[model samples]
Target: MTQPNIVIPPAEQQTSVEAGDLLNSSTAGVIVERTAQVRNGFHAEGRKFARMMAEFVNVKQVGVASVFVYEETFGIKDKLHWLIHLSSLEAYEAMVHMGTSDQEYRGNVSSEQVSQDKGGGGWDKIFVDGSMQETVLMPQFWGMYGTKVDGEREKQTSVYQQQGPLTGLPGAREQVPLPVEQLVHSGNCGLLLHRTAQLEYDFRSEGRTFAREAAESINENLPGEATVFVYEEAFGAADRIHWLIHMKSLTTYYKVLALHVKDERIRDLYFQERIAPERGGGTWARMFVPGSMVDVALTPHHWGMYAT
Candidate 1:
């Protein structure tokens, strides 16, 4: 198999504020998540597969892959999720090409001994048939998505590196020099909330505006405790938007919920949307497709890629 020549930006050149940000990519910060329902009694075995997968993929240097399992409190209780953070769509294509075509990756998966179980049938045995779903998201913020020049990407990354700790807002205090190595896999976030919504036709702009404002509100209220990111689907359902909320811990999750309920800024924004403009509020009712909201919370199952 012919290997694609891949150029990876040095860790220092990449900027990311979330668990999904493993490397800086050219395609507006791509995050590909694969979710699968695991067969009963195979949780441990599934985790082992996740570890192996992450090890192989990260070593290839095409991208970083981390495995997460759904928390019982949210989404399906028995599923494993793998999030692959790549530098670009091209990088993702290369990873897929090499993963399937290269003998190093294929040999391990196809080998009979890949599974430790006595009845070894390889790693595929751990999951239910036809339960896996993959979704592609491009992280977005402000009015713009992730479109950035090489120099802009590098500059943003550098700013984050100098910010020292998450609690310190940019330019709010003296900068602290944070090593690129340490910041790359901070491992501070343990839970990720995945929420999806579908916008009505002609209302995509309004939905995006609301999302941008909501994210800004959350950041202003919580600062380093929690972070909210908006993304538009690069693939999958049309008009579907996604939100990824990275929480420092389980406690932070509850704290965020409370903030949403009690914070005036958040409530006001919702009120404007729910009420009609004629009533001196927003037309949020018309902005989104009813019954299109979905929420799932994921917790780290293994630190395989990050550990390496």
Candidate 2:
């Protein structure tokens, strides 16, 4: 990211004031400070809420001083304070009328003619007054478990510069595979994982029966023990599935089959049956009821499959 340009005007051309002048003058200025604890989340006791502080300024002849606070995070703007204007009753009324008629007014105050530059220049002795504090809370969670299929383990080892064979071919150098463990852990629900020999199947019908029929067809035809995972749309699940299958005779290695369905409910039902219950220790391979693999064997052209 490019750094923001910080333009500092010449000292001679800038205006300066003391805290006393700011409280007494009928002009506008801003009060800025560094804060380590800003409110975050819906509840108190949340993690670090640090923020840079800025207060909009509106000065008046009266003793009332109104300060509005604002904070920006992740490129989003949020209002943290209210419109405060310190002025006499008459002055307040006039400011309001001016604000209502003037097109250039940017301050949130209801009045016009009140100076809007939070002191336009800068001020000294901007002492800290009593603070208003609030507690903030943030929540997080995790789930799921699986082993990295052999090929992925090999690839990860190669990238990490671990001592390993340069290639998987036999009669060549036997590289040491990296030591990486596959385990179940808590995480978001929609992440996708890519694995070998499995193809994504897209169905075009609008009902659960159609999906079940398709699944049965694919399950029956593929080599026994071949792993298959079905997803309605790419990235629909937080963590995607990894399939393992053998296909030495086929030219294309991994097939991503697209199943187009007109009914959303049918697609959802299919997904739920195929991928939702791994948490209970039931194996995905076993989830394929008999006859699930029959569709792929019959309608090779009606479905679209891509190899990765």
Candidate 3:
């Protein structure tokens, strides 16, 4: 599909997904990275502000995701990792562009680009300026699966679950997945696990095979438990692949991690078998967005709740 080229005006306060939307675009989803310590009042406020802009500004609603990663290796609860999904890079830039406009920009667009345009950076008092750590994600090949049939029960625990349907993107509704509710259940909370590794060989040839093997493991053993995503680092610490796991329940979330830690064949493929080696730097985290954060969960028209 030819992605529409969209250039939103700064301060326009209206959303537009001229380029392909993120939920299912093969080449979309710019991992919006921000260095944030979990539960800081200002930082959390900044995230919510940006999300509000995306909800109100664009021609179509785009999601502002807060994906938190929990890695036992770090044992640092003070630092929190998160991902806010904008429709595209342009959409992100435009959202931040509001910072340079007439009104003060309260949202933390990226850690680096906080504006002095309004009161010489005083806005950080309410919302700290943080930089967007860059990353390379796998092309959107890992998608929602195990869909709930049309008349079956729907499971959605997203902050945006109550938000309207997705629009301006393929696979948002028609293909890829269906009614956002099916992607996850309502009572559940979400957790994201991002693991970055340095490849010893080309994953396209070798790593992919291992990934497939791992996927098969999930399907066979931990069925309907989690959604797995592998991302190649495009910006942060060079040469890294981030593996993201989105889970619905705390029960399944912990189970999958325990499974990975003990499983030998899966461990051999990456660790013992020598495919991708640790770069001595990576994080595994379980991100949970408060169900009360309805403002943060507001998503775009084309957004999907889950695969099933």
Give per-model TM-scores. 0.70, 0.16, 0.46
Rank by TM-score (best first): 1, 3, 2
Highest TM-score, which number? 1
Which number leads on lDDT?
1
Better of 2 and 3 by TM-score: 3
Ranking by lDDT: 1, 3, 2
RMSD (Cα, Å) of model 1: 11.2
Q: Which tens-of-lDDT digit does each residue in 188-236 have in candidate 1?
A: 4555677888987656656776765676576666655566666778767
Per-residue lDDT over 76-95 for candidate 3, one digit per residue giving the tens place of the 0 to 100 score: 33233333444555556665
Query: Cα deviation in Å at residue 107, candidate 2?
Result: 10
Clashes of 1: 3
Instruction: Report the candidate with higher lDDT, 1 versus 3.
Output: 1
